[model samples]
Target: MKEKHTWLDAVWRILLYFWALTIVFPLCWVLYESLKTNPEFYQDIWALPKQLNWQNYADAWTDYGFGKSLLNTLYYVGGTLIVSLFFTTINAYALTRMEFKGRNLIWGLIMLSLFLPGVNALVPQYVVMRELGLTNSIPGLILLSGLGESVFYLMLLGGFMRSLPKELEESAIMDGASLFQKFWRVIVPLSTPGIVTVAVFKFLGYYNNFMGPFIYLSDPEKYPIAVQMYSANKQMEYTADWVTLFAGVAISMVPSIIIYMLFQRLLMEGATMGAVKG
Candidate 1:
């Protein structure tokens, strides 16, 4: 049994190493390519650069408008994070813990909506945005996304909230904690792992979101990194500045990597919060 278990573990380890290579290799290749000039890149696609062309990054940053787009993205993403986290936490707490009329029914309806295709709502959403005069503005986009409830976030947070002991809330109540106090003080603090997990996931999604911003934001100044990179890539078809494009692509990946590295522990803890029994 021990021998078999050891062999199984070895196989899993090998697979994991291969998977890591698949992800890391492309990222390293992009970083390497970003360091080359056009002539060096054209001379040898696979070979290392003759000299590090740091100018490509500078050109990508200023010429490609990554600086402005990055700022816009930070504004959009930061606002959405604050608003969505607050609302989602409240909604999850109410759905999972607070007993009220039609709570299950509401949850059931929300779950049922999951079966419907989201693409179908694009037209109506666009129309509403137009009517509300929200198109082409970052704050408008923030409100649109933040106000929208995500089923996946709800489910992840609800599961974590459900796993908390009712005794904690009872203790808070005995001490005369009000409804908002119970949630803001007792629940929010306890659910930090789950909230952080949701935050990291949402950050990735918001950062990479292309279609929403692309459809709504027509101004180049308002573009997020994803949309900006895409526009730059299209321009590359004519200008053929592949190295600079690579540089922008590499720069665009930095935030996601940093966010994942920082919050990875909390993310892992939150992921398993519901599975482990107290």
Candidate 2:
């Protein structure tokens, strides 16, 4: 039995290593390509750069307007997180904890919306933004992006909330705590894992969003990192600076990486907790 178990463990370890490599290899290749000259990149696609090209990052930062674009991305991401998290949390709390009429129907509708392709609404969304004179504005983009609570987040947090002891809220209510107080002091604090998970998702989504800004933002100065990267790639014909373009891509990815690394534990806990409970 011990011999059989040892063989199984060895096979599992090899499979796990292969799985990790499948995901990690592409990222490593990108990093390697970012350091190579265009000719070298084409010549040896899988090999490491002969020497690290640190100037690529600096060139990308300055010439590609990534510095300004980074700032704009930070604003959009921060605003989206603030607005989306606020609404999602409140909506989740109400749907899960409070009694209401037609709750199931409302939830069903939200689930249906999740199935609708986002592109289908683009024309209408653009018209509304134009009418509101929100085109090319960061706040407008943030508000439009944060229009509704995602069913996924609502359902995830609802599961976590369900797993909590009802007696906690009941005792607070018996102690003369208002509904707002209970939410603010008791539930919100306990729901940290769910909140962190939701925030991480929103942050990543907002940071990487390109289409909305591309269609609405006419001014180059107002463009975010993703748009700026697009612009950089396009201008490479006149500029002929592949290094800067790669650098811009690398820079654009950093914030999302940092955020995921920081909140990875919370994200995993929230996702697994919701999945198991639900």
Candidate 3:
């Protein structure tokens, strides 16, 4: 059934649209500001630029080392996503479907850890990284992110996995499929929506991560786009070349925006189904 229309509903819609504009207008302003010169920006912040200058993006790319930072960010994000998602997928399946001793207890323990503040673990993480000789390196950062795993992803996927029918696993079992084979062939494929949801989130977290790179990485060149953008903004303050700084901010925003746009449907589905089923 369609949702009933009412004056309150109409008013709510209008309020939501107004709220949306509040967020979008700033992004629009920043995008246009990135095309203006320093003088033009100061003269009239809201006015359109007389000319489109692609040079801000170029300067942001080269002068700010965004190119290198982008590669490093991708490396960290991709590597962490691959490793974390792999374990999250299998673990979610096991906890949700496969009967095992202490399964619920393990899930409870994992969820319980989420209540503990992440900040408290920083010193121990650093010490462990130092002992393992993984500090100040991209791979080290990747490992750090992938380590401990994410209780959120596990929970989200476990919820989604519960919604899947047991018949698929039973059919695979009748075919003499082993545990790994059943999971690889049957479970993983059906779980794509939930997996995509997890991937999209992990991408955003890794892309915009500042604390991890800032703490673990001493090398400026190894900094991810988030940290690099911060450094670029700080340097640009002296020059007052606000356009390029805005360009860097715009660049950093692009991936998360793009990923969310592409996977929005799956994200909603994963959220809804996970919540309902789990």
Model 2 residue 27 CA deviation (Å) reads 1.9
For model 2, how does the per-residue alpha-carbon lDDT over 1-278 read when each residue is reduced to its tens digit? Answer: 54456788889999999999998887777777788787776677778889988788887777779999999989888888898898888888888888889988988898899889888989998999999999989999999988756777888888887777889999999999999999999999999998888888878777878998999999999899989988988898896777557767777878888998999999999889878875
Separately for all candidates shown, the number of backbone clashes (residues 3 or more apart, or on different chains) is 0, 0, 0
Candidate 2 TM-score over all chains jointly: 0.91
Best of the two (2, 3) by lDDT = 3
User: Which ten-residue region of model 2 has the weakest summed lDDT?
Assistant: 1-10
Show the lowest summed lDDT stretch of 10 residues, model 3: 143-152
Which of 2 and 3 is the better model by TM-score? 3
* Of candidates 2 and 1, the better by lDDT: 1
For each candidate, give its TM-score against the true structure.
Answer: 0.96, 0.91, 0.95
User: Any runs in candidate 2 off by more than 4 Å, and if so which?
Assistant: 1-15
**In candidate 3, what are the lDDT values of residues 50-70, reduced to their tens digit?**
999889999888888887898
User: What does candidate 1's lDDT look like per residue over 152-258, in tens digits?
Assistant: 99999989999899999999999999999999999999999999988998898899988899999999999999999999999987999999999999989988999
Give the whole-model CA lDDT for all candidates, comma-separated. Answer: 0.92, 0.85, 0.89
After superposition on all CA atoms, how large is the RMSD of candidate 1? 1.7
**Highest-TM-score candidate:** 1
RMSD (Cα, Å) for all candidates, in order, is 1.7, 2.3, 1.5
Whichever of 1 and 3 has more lDDT, that candidate is: 1
**lDDT (Cα, 0-100) at 110 in candidate 3:** 90
